[model samples]
Target: MPRPARTTPSRRALLGSAAVLSLALGGLAACSTSEETQAAAQSTAGGSSTYPLTLTSPFGETTLEEKPEKVAVVSSVDLDIALSLGVVPVISPLYGEAELDPWETTALEGLGESDLTTYDSTDGVDYEAIAAAAPDVILATSGWTLDEDYEQLSKIAPIVSFQGADGLTGMTWAERTAEAGKALDLAAKAQEVVDGVAAKFEAAAAAHPEFAGRTYTYAVIHPEQITYESYDGSDTSFFERLGFTLPAAASRFSAGNQAVSRENVDVLDADVLLVGYPFGDEGLLTRSALESDALFQQVPAVAGKHYAVVDDLVASPLAYPTPLSEVWVLDQLVPVLATAVAGS
Candidate 1:
């Protein structure tokens, strides 16, 4: 028999829409005093409460009401995190190639979305759609923040923007996840999920001895022949958390070089090639996309068939916050790589 679907809370049942919107947008006109703000900030750490609570984010500080039910997530990753916590929001936008192309619907299966309004990040958000949903809390980042847009979103509800404190811009996915969780008073649960992923990664690493000595490269390739490789201590926080060894060839590039040209493909000289396939064919990397390309065909990985195509599931930045993503990676990607190495 198939496994039962996980129980989740309804968007409307999660929080009071009007009150949540007020707290998120800093529009608590009813309680404008500093004492009111402090009182509301004191209530949200991890339980169901009506009191307001303050949270420190990668961007700055924002206060949220306890057990916020209606959440509007700007990032799909944030959506996944909220879903994992059993809080389904009114509207959550999709991201990456998996989300945009082929109208990526599989990723959102069981998330309770059916013909909901979608927003384009490139041209800013769809205010009309957001207003129609009547969301109470809006979760986004300074990276995508526009002053006018922010002001407009604030008008609709309370908005939580993820920014880094001090020198920290919340660049890492883990930090951002933690910040969001804290804002919702879900820190312990988030940490537990993260720790579970770490444990699973350790087991997978132990089971695959071939991966021990091998250096691997993780690259995000675009149709334009530009490749963006992962770097240590960079924005690729999931990889960092999993403790995967990166290819030495990536060292030649700078820290922020998320995209690379065809000329740079030669520099990815690792024993194994792990390419992210968020768009197009899901198994492009494992197959022969590299061989078809004259520049990449010469790489030792392609020649030796040492490439592994990662699924769009765990391969996305959006899904990085969920333990389910970890299961998909270690259970699916690791064995595929092991088999490829053995055959090659």
Candidate 2:
């Protein structure tokens, strides 16, 4: 995912470009006056927070000696949040780099930043590689093995582990953005990012009033496993932000987050059935594979051609919808879903 190495642009320069993207892309005409106006507005807005910012994690409190300069993020969520704030990390997790959605590439190119250093962390933390990067801060909002490695990582730089007090759930998009803001001393810019995305969601929901009160269900159909995983339906779900809700009948399956057998696949019934394939597992679960299954064929939504199957690459971002991924995905997904709602 890393392009060729070039001189790393300073964060301040990237910050200006990011601000320009936000305003110019947000329905305003591009002009010198408009660009200068945003720059002037952000001079006061972007630096409102004071540092030696002290942030807490389950492991311990890590205090920034001053605002962090070189950021190293370890998860896609953290990477997206940092990019939203215009800081291209010195390093990020390797899997995180592989999962760079298109929106993230746009953000990186917008900042004129590239060739990020990343280490494979599939098994555990690569403490040596991370230490070698010598980051001003490590944004581990969704990192792994932190309980064991937090103290070790702290030796390299202050680790901003997930804001989740329990050290399990990690931070939401807003929380991560806000926390990263505090560490970077860009609290006002962070809030603007949060508010800006919230406005986009609101606008989407307004545009798709028909999405309101729609009943839906989500699952991963594993042909190899021969089962369907039902994600717990939530009233306050990401889909809910776009005015969709899980079906009441689906609530029974949601409680267990269980794998419904092919025989019992009728339980996935809903006005809209949103399906996902595991990245490699897509080969196992083909359209014909489902058609050959007699019982799976009877599922109401599928029978009615009212199901939308999202490719895993596209669905990966929604696994933890950050500010960057959600906007692009919504634009692409809504039309397909609206068609499903219309029953062809």
Candidate 3:
């Protein structure tokens, strides 16, 4: 039997302030707050009841005695969330590809190139580099932060790492937005951002009733290996929220993604297919090869031309969903789907 259909719940209802903080602080021991830390927390806590916030992550609980002015983000989504919440970090690391994604480019607009420092963190977090940025608080909420990395970063500033069992991926975009809001003391604004994007999804669904009840799958083509990896509904939560459904054939995989050889390409039978590739000529060539293959052509989405090719920049934001990235994806994704399912 196929896996049961996944349910998308409201992050706010599921992770209330107390629950979220408790889950985050579950494994860590309580420690005494220093005088300097207490002073900073009191000053930055502003007038809100949630001030002097204590954020729990995989590493431990980090209590912020005050608002963090010079913030540094290890993950792109964290950085984007910070910017969306009107808090620009002193340093924001690149998301694997070694450059800013399209959403980041738009978010960083109006600020000088030097205003936000950028660096590569593909291998691991650079302790010295991030320490040099001198952030009052470090946001590693959506990155691959190991315990040792957290230990070192903590020495520089209070660090907030990923929460829940799935780490970064466990938290929905809404949850991440809410967490960022709480951390930065912009809870109201964060809710506004989440509601706005949700409104956009509702509008898109209403505009394109054709999208309802349709199944879709997103895949990354690896032409050289004659294999393509299919992503789970969690990875395409935004699409699912916009009224699309995931095919059971593609959703049964345990890893939320599965690699299928060319011989099994028929498994990816969906009303719409969203293909992604790395940026540059190599990715283009790979996508082209997959598009031309006789095996892939046999797939329903390919046979009917109901597919869209998304490059790294466009796909990055979706991979790490944020308020800004959600808006960006809807703006680009809705039209593509509309066109793909037009005559069907």
Best by TM-score: 2
Please give me the total number of clashing residue pairs in predicted model 2: 0
lDDT of each: 0.50, 0.64, 0.62
Report each candidate's C-alpha RMSD, comma-separated, in the order given: 11.1, 9.3, 10.5
Candidate with the greatest lDDT versus the true structure: 2
TM-scores of the candidates are 0.64, 0.79, 0.75
Cα lDDT of model 1 by residue, 122-235, tens digit: 344667767877876776643243344666776676666666443123344455555556666667656665676678777776776666656677775444434545655445
Ranking by lDDT: 2, 3, 1
Tens digits of lDDT, candidate 2, 164-229: 564445347787778777777778878988898888889988988888988887765543433333
Question: Lowest summed lDDT over 10 consecutive residues: which window, candidate 1?
Answer: 20-29
Candidate 3 structure lDDT: 0.62
Residue 66 error, candidate 1, Å: 4.6
TM-score of 3: 0.75
